[model samples]
Target chain A: MKPLDKIQSIAAYLDEDAVDTDIIFPARFLLLMDKKGLGGHAFHERRRVKKGETPFILDRPPFDTAEILVAGKDFGTGSSREQAVWALADLGLRCIIAETFGEIFYANCFKNGVLPIRLDADTLARVRQAAGREEEIVVDLPSQTIVLTGDETISYDVDAYRKEALLLGLDEIAVILRDSGKDIKAFEEGQSRRAPWLRLGPDKWKVFDDLEKEQFIE
Target chain B: MHAHDRPRTLYQKVWDDHVVSTYQDGTQLIYVDRHLVQEVSSPQAFVGLDAAGRDLHRPEAHMAVADHAVPTTERTATLREGLAASQVARLSTNAARHHIPYVPMTDRRHGIVHVIGPELGFTLPGAVLVCGDSHTCTHGAFGAVAFGIGASECECVFATQVLRQSRQKSMRIRLEGVCPEGVQVKDVILAVIARIGVGGGVGHAMEFAGSAVRAMTMEQRMTLCNMAVEAGSRIGLVAPDETTFAYLKGRPLAPTDTEWDAAVANWRELASDSDAVFDQEFEIDVSSLSPFITWGTTPEESAPISGRVPDPAAIDDPRVRRRVERSLRYMALEPNTPLSGIAIDRVFIGSCTNGRIEDLRSAAAVVAGRKVHPRVQAMVVPGSASVRLQAEAEGLDRIFSEAGFDWRHSGCSMCVGMNDDRLLEGERCASTSNRNFEGRQGRGGRTHLMSPAMAAAAAVSGHLADVRDLWPEGTK
Candidate 1:
């Protein structure tokens, strides 16, 4: 993942609320485990209602190259599929401005170097208007602001940790393993002594008995 | 300071117990007690781990199963090569390489990740459980601090056995009063989602309490907590009690003998302090909630069976009205039409939400002397093979098949629409699955979410009929 500092592009507008993960990236494509090439499947329903036709707003002229999306409240509201972000990022979207986002999706956006910004209703209305006109918008991560048409700027809030992670393109797993290894080892050692039953070893598992086995096994 | 000195909600207690490290930004690296993996969401996580040259930190603490990708039909000697097969194969290889406990498709214990976790006693009180699927909240029924994680987080768990998480505000929803007759546990959860709109529980850890929740069986409690994600809350918890202990007693992975006593003693303390404060609180009288069902797209876009399709014109909020109008259009429903009179093309009675033995028995009881309507193609897919066997032992499968319904093998089935069991385009279905989103069952497929018994009733009547009106005589 590359560090995301700023993006300047037209914002594609999705006017619907509760634009859930399923709608963004349908559940059917979940079997496609490879994260790449999902841009073709994002919003699979809306992008092409028929073969050889692209009717969705994102597929249209000026918005086709959009790196920013302005959507209604509760965007990415269903499922914890990270593929939703993968698909959007694959679709060339770098930032999403919404009234609110599903908490898991919001967290995932930062992990994938996609910024999810929750703006106030009034500011969101202005952003929506700018998106409707296909006006160019600039999202600057360092400044934590979205610049709309006519130089009108709106500030947004993101977790300090997530913003830093996104800007630096830090691999969170590597960072944790490097910084917190000792603490993690200590916690586990202490927990095992206090609650041995909680940390069962492989040999301790007792899932089946020979007699009742007939009931569970084929 | 002693842990007991500070008043804490069940969530706070569990969160405090799992904190391995805290960062300056207020996020904590919380140790995960149990990790459940399924085929669809896990393959990429394994790839990422391998790409990072990381080894699984605790393979013994994780379990993997191929549920969503497996067909709910009789298994062939081997799966034909394809996307589904490749995904399942990848998971199997990953499990073997990582030494994680893998339940193959042929294993009787193989079932929906959430269902098998509790069934095999892998889920326990006070454990911090996670899976890539959002329905992992089902484990919270046992007082576990369980929630869903993305595949990236799954890799983190594999690499470090901990996840970085910020604290969530606590919300307690009290289901007061005795549940009225004809109300299923599914109805209780659906009613709760309806009360708190899909986004109502966002950013909060929901604790289901009050008398009605206490009266529920472990299976019933699982049903209630399974759809917590549908309400936009990542976690839904019920404090462990005698019911929870009884359910865990002698299960395959559960503690036994002296260890059992010790585990139970610890679990007894996994409850909210009497005077603990919640960030937000809501109380719903279960006595007042009737059999709930989704009439439109979203889970919250539902009303009681006695109600009619809402007229979008009557809605005051333009955004909500537009959404409703679009939902009604896709559902092919008209305003003011009685919910019961809406005809269906199919009936599907299963999912993590309502696919347990109890759910099967309830549906079977309704179809005991009846037959599926000639126009309806109904099926019952158990949550797991264990659940299927248990249902068969009780002869529920016979009742379902005798009623002209398909009694199929266990998997996610039509609930996810990734397998062979799917609704054809524009097909209207009365299903027990959680989500009713467009294309959820299949592209252009319409779904009306209901309880298993209600789904069975729809199979018999070929419409969204009330289970109460069709209950077999002499049965409650």
Candidate 2:
């Protein structure tokens, strides 16, 4: 995964609180085995203005060129459907800025290599206003600076570990692997000593052994 | 410390004590005590178990139930849907394989797991409980630290009985004074959500306390805790009181006589000390809270029942404004439209959240003399077989039937999209369940979350009218 340096273009802001996974990728779309076609149907209910015609959001100028989303608090609040994050990612939304995000959705965003930036209410308002004006909004990850075309800029805070993960394109699992260099072996040894029943299956034991080897080698 | 400076909130005390080891990555591996499992999401965890060929490390500490996918009609030999049938069957098999106690569909003890847990005394005060179902926070009413977990996390709990959690800052939400007449606990939670704007509780553990909270029954507290997730909090809790002890006194899993006495003594100490600290505190005057109805897709986008739908253009926040407009368009609701006159097609009055005996009694009281609207479809499902039997003995079922509601068996019918019980496309329902998420009741079905009495009132009126209007004069 390429490191995110800065965001250049702003998406026409779509604002909704608790935009659930169901609305993003409806249950009908879940039938499709391939995830590539999902981006086409992203926000399908909102895309059709008159059942057949493309909706205003899709036909609008900034949304057509936008690669980032500015959203409200509790953005993406419902079910733990990874497909929602996948749909956003496939739709070319590289970054999302919100005042707050759902616990699971925030994790999913990082896992899918999408930058979910938490901004203060004032900063988020500015970004939302900028999107409305079709003005360029720039977000420099390293400097934690959000700049609008009118020479307006704001600095936001990101957790150091999350920033590192986003920069390295590593997820929680990746971080676990990276950090568990010796811990995995120690955990396995403890498991073997404490609970012998966990060591019954050769395949099961091999799975843990493989995980240890993978993390140790890395 | 000043009088208000002391820890007057229950959230502060629980959070402060539950902090386990914080990882270098900023996440904490908080210890979890009780793990609750259900048919819907536990199957995936079992599949993970099969792949790993792992046995449950603490099977005795885990419990499973069939709730979401089971039918409310009857515990038949076979289920109507193949997937639903297979899921319930797998839960039974998996529970047996792992030595986890299970409340299967056919069992007389069966019901929504969250409902039965507290009633049967499985949810103890101060214990951390987690389930794959979102409303698992319902257990928090018993003063238990509870929240929802995903399937992968459920596996982690099954394997280790401990969740890798990031501890939240505590927020004490103090509600002073007595609740005004006709204002139910549901309204209190809604008012809190409305004031907090959903994300207000994010990264914060909310402890609901004060005179108003202490006055509520165990069932009412459960309803308040049930929607904690709606406020974007992982858990909602209240300190255990006399009401909590009374509710747990004689249940099957509750402590025996001597143990019960001892348990009560310990539970008394669970309250926050007068000098405990909290990260944040907010006070709400209970007298000001009114009956609330959600008008938009989200719970936070709500207003008083007598109030008009908010115009998105009037909102100062651009993000909130844009979403409100979109939600209004999708819901087919107009700005400034009167919420009272909107018609409802169905009424659902059962879930882990609000399917207890008291909730049924309240609904039954409202439906006693009123006939359900001619066009509306109404169903009354109890939380568990025990609740159903108790209601039947009290003739609550007859009142529900007379009012044109289908008095059905126990299960999480219509609350989630796992079962055959669902609202048809474009159908609007007055539901007593937690969550009004799009497609939660059914694909394209709209849900209006409310109290059971409010749902009953709507069933009779066939609209989103206020329950206060339906009550007899001087009754409140």
True contacts kept of each: 0.65, 0.12
Q: Which candidate is the best by DockQ?
A: 1
Clash count for each candidate, listed in order shown: 0, 1
Q: State the lDDT of candidate 1 residue by residue for B133-225, as single tens digits.
A: 899989999999999989999999999999989989899999889766677888888988988889899999999999989998999999988
Instruction: Report how far residue B13 has shifted in candidate 1, in Å.
Output: 0.4
RMSD of 2: 7.7
- What docking grade applies to model 2? incorrect
| Per-chain TM-score (chain B), model 1 | 0.98
lDDT of each candidate versus the true structure:
0.89, 0.74
Candidate 2 local lDDT, B266-300, one digit each (tens): 67877877777778788999898778888878777
What TM-score, over all chains together, does every model reach?
A: 0.97, 0.81
RMSD of each: 2.6, 7.7
> lDDT: which candidate is best?
1
